[model samples]
Target: MQIGIPKEIKNNENRVAITPAGVINLVHAGQSVAVETRAGVVAGYSDQDYIDAGAIIVDAATAWGQDMVIKVKEPLASEYQYFRPGLILYTYLHLAANRPLTEALLASRVTAIGYETMIAPDGSLPLLTPMSQVAGRMAVQLGSQFLQTQYGGKGVLLGSVPGVAKCHVVIIGGGVVGLNAAKIALGMGAQVTVLDINPKILARIDDEFEGKVQTLFSDHQNLTLAVAAADLVIGAVLIPGAVAPKLVTAAMIRNMAPGSVVVDIPIDQGGIFETTTHATTFADPVYVVDGVIHYAVANIPGAVPKTATDALTAVTIPYAAKIGKLGVTDAAKADRMIFTGVNTYAGELTEQAVAESLNLPFHSLSTRL
Candidate 1:
């Protein structure tokens, strides 16, 4: 099997899909890897590193022309020209909210496998979890940064001095993102509260935090109150292959204090805040909305590509190697998780959740197969 590793072209997305070590592993698995020039440079790996690990250094077109193209982020409009029939695109393709990319993949008959949609035996999103952890932790850091007076923030310190009150951090959702956000916020001495609709998840948070963090049922009443009182609110909600629910309404935003900040971590899925109309890049990550700061950087982990790239490849390499060895058809047949990862195949929308989110017809993977 031939695999291609292309340099990520998204704004400020410095992470490469596969590291040199990952290439070594794939090579030993009877797979050939071609890495685009300078793909791993920003992530601290040089082209010589990939060469030493038995990977061919090639041009973008040559790399993308391989049997399977593994990438960090979804393909941008410019890269869509590389899409073709029988090409396997393995990446973190948030297709639910990306109608253009979804339609393009179907039209090109590309075999699209979304990393976020793959389900582990325990129903965990293995490929998406590492980035989620990075983003969640970074959300707190970004929130803290944006909370400074220089950034037009409230001028309050997160872990205030003895004479001052600590910042109040409210996190929505109790998934991987929420838990990591709470961990960072608490470590910084902020008073943390987590909200979720599932009682079981709330119970888990309660047990995990040992009462240090408050848990609330995420209803309109509780959300309204939490948002109003929050000095920093982290929206970490996710619906897997569907768009993120608009959990934070404009009224709720209006009710918050003037200098408060809200970080929407799931902005890739159309955002959880009604005020987040467009995704922001790290170049310009925040905006003032009704005197409140809204941080909607779509790829928060990209800010720490050195740490994020290694963490990501550690998990994704094994899956990519598996797919490389067996090919998409055989791999999907052998592993249910691989089947769940398929978003498009043979000119059809295979992922039901993504299809429903786009208001398009859904076809089962089995039917497409």
Candidate 2:
């Protein structure tokens, strides 16, 4: 089987789908790997590295002609037109919130396997967790930097000294993103409060931090109070491949203190706040929605390409190689977990979550398996 690795086309997304080591392993396993020119350059892997690993360098279309195509983000509008009937486009197709992209996949009849929707036996997102961790950590750094008056944030230091008040940060959701945000906020000496609907999450965090950070029961009233008092608000929530619940509303943002900072990580999935819409580039990642500073960079980890590329490759390589060797149909038939974006087997929504999210009829993969 031939596996294609394409350079990410998403704005400021420098991470590649695979690494030189990954290429080497796939080749050793009797699979052909094709990489586009400069695909791994931003990730610090030279084209020569892929060549040395026995991968053939090719253009985008030629690479996509392979049995399986691995990528970081969804294809652009133009690339969607290139989608053939039988090609397996394995990537992070965040389609639940992307109506247009989802429509294109269904029309093209491509066997799409979303990286973010791949769940392990433990019900954790194995492939998406690394990227979430990077995004989570960067959310704090970005929020902290943007909070300075110079960067358009309140003139408050995260770690306050004598005769100064500490920055108060309110983070929604206690999943991977929220936890990582809390770590950075606490490390910076800010007053951190993480709210979540799950008591299990709160209990675990309480035990982990030993009262270092506040864990609050998630409710509209508590959230409103927290946001009103917060110097920075980080929106980090996930509903699998579906759109994130709108936990933070425009009215809530209007009630916040002026000059307060908000970083909405779920903006890619339509956001957990009413104010945010997806931004195209890192150059202008925010807009004043409801008069609050919104930092809704969907590819938040793209800011640190070197670290993100290495981490992303670590989690996706094994799975990519498995599907590459076994073929998409066989892999999907064998392990149901690998069949996330089967929106159209021969042009039908094989995944129920995707169908419901997109308002399309759901068809079971078992019917065709």
Candidate 3:
């Protein structure tokens, strides 16, 4: 099997799909790897490092021209030219909110596997979890930076000194992202609160935090009040393979104190805020909305590419090795979790949630196979 690692062209997306160690694993599995020159440079892996790992350095076209292409983020418009029939694309496709990319994959007849959609037997998103953890921790750090008056924030420190009021950190999900965010916020000495629609999740959070963090039911009334009083509101909601529900309305933004920061973690899937018109890049990560700062960078983990790359490759390598040893079809047939990751196969949309989200026809993977 021939695998390709292309350099990420997305704005500030420094992480590469595979590290040199990952390339060594694939090579040890008797698979050929072609890494685009400088693809792993920003992530601290050099071309010589890949060569040492038995991967051949190639140009972008050569890298994209392999049997299977693995990437960190989804392909941008320019990279669309590389899509073609019989090519296997393994990456975070987030197709529910990306109609253009979804259409392009179908039109090109590419076998698209989304890391975010792959669910293990235990109902965990294995590939997406590591990056989600990084993003979740980053949300608090970024929000704190934006909360400074110099950056148009309310001049509030996350960890207040003695005799000062601690900042309020409100997270709107109790999943992996939300839990990790709460951990960071709490460690910083800020008052943390988590809201979720699932009572079990709320209970788990309460138990895990040992009652140090406040847990609230994610109802309209509770959300409204929380948003109005929140010093930092983190939108961490996710519906898995579907567009995120817009829970924060414009009116809610208006009620937030001026300089209060709101970080939307699920911006790739259309975001949880109505004011999120477009995803921001690291170059320009925030904008003022109704006197509140909105941080909606689509690739939060990309900011720490070295850590992000290593963490991401740790989980994805096992799956990639399997896919390389056997073809995608055989590997997917052997593991149902891998099959669940298949978003597009043979020119048809195979993921039901993505098809429904895009208003396209859904074809089950079983039928497609």
Best by lDDT: 3
Ranking by TM-score: 3, 1, 2
Query: How big is the positional error of residue 363 in model 2, measured in Å on the Cα after superposition?
Result: 0.9
Per-residue alpha-carbon lDDT of candidate 1 for residues 241-342, written as tens digits (9 for 90 to 100): 999999999999999999899999988999999998889998898999988999998888888889999999898888788898888998999888899999
For candidate 3, the 10 contiguous residues with the lowest summed lDDT are 360-369
- Tell me which of candidates 2 and 3 scores higher on lDDT: 3
Candidate 2 residues 308-342, lDDT tens each?
87888888877777787788778877775786545
What's model 1's lDDT at 298?
A: 88
Error of 3 at 342 (Å): 0.2
Two-way TM-score contest, 1 vs 2, winner: 1
Preferred candidate (lDDT higher): 1 or 3: 3
TM-score of 3: 0.99
- C-alpha positional error of residue 265 in candidate 2 after TM-score superposition, expressed in Å: 0.6
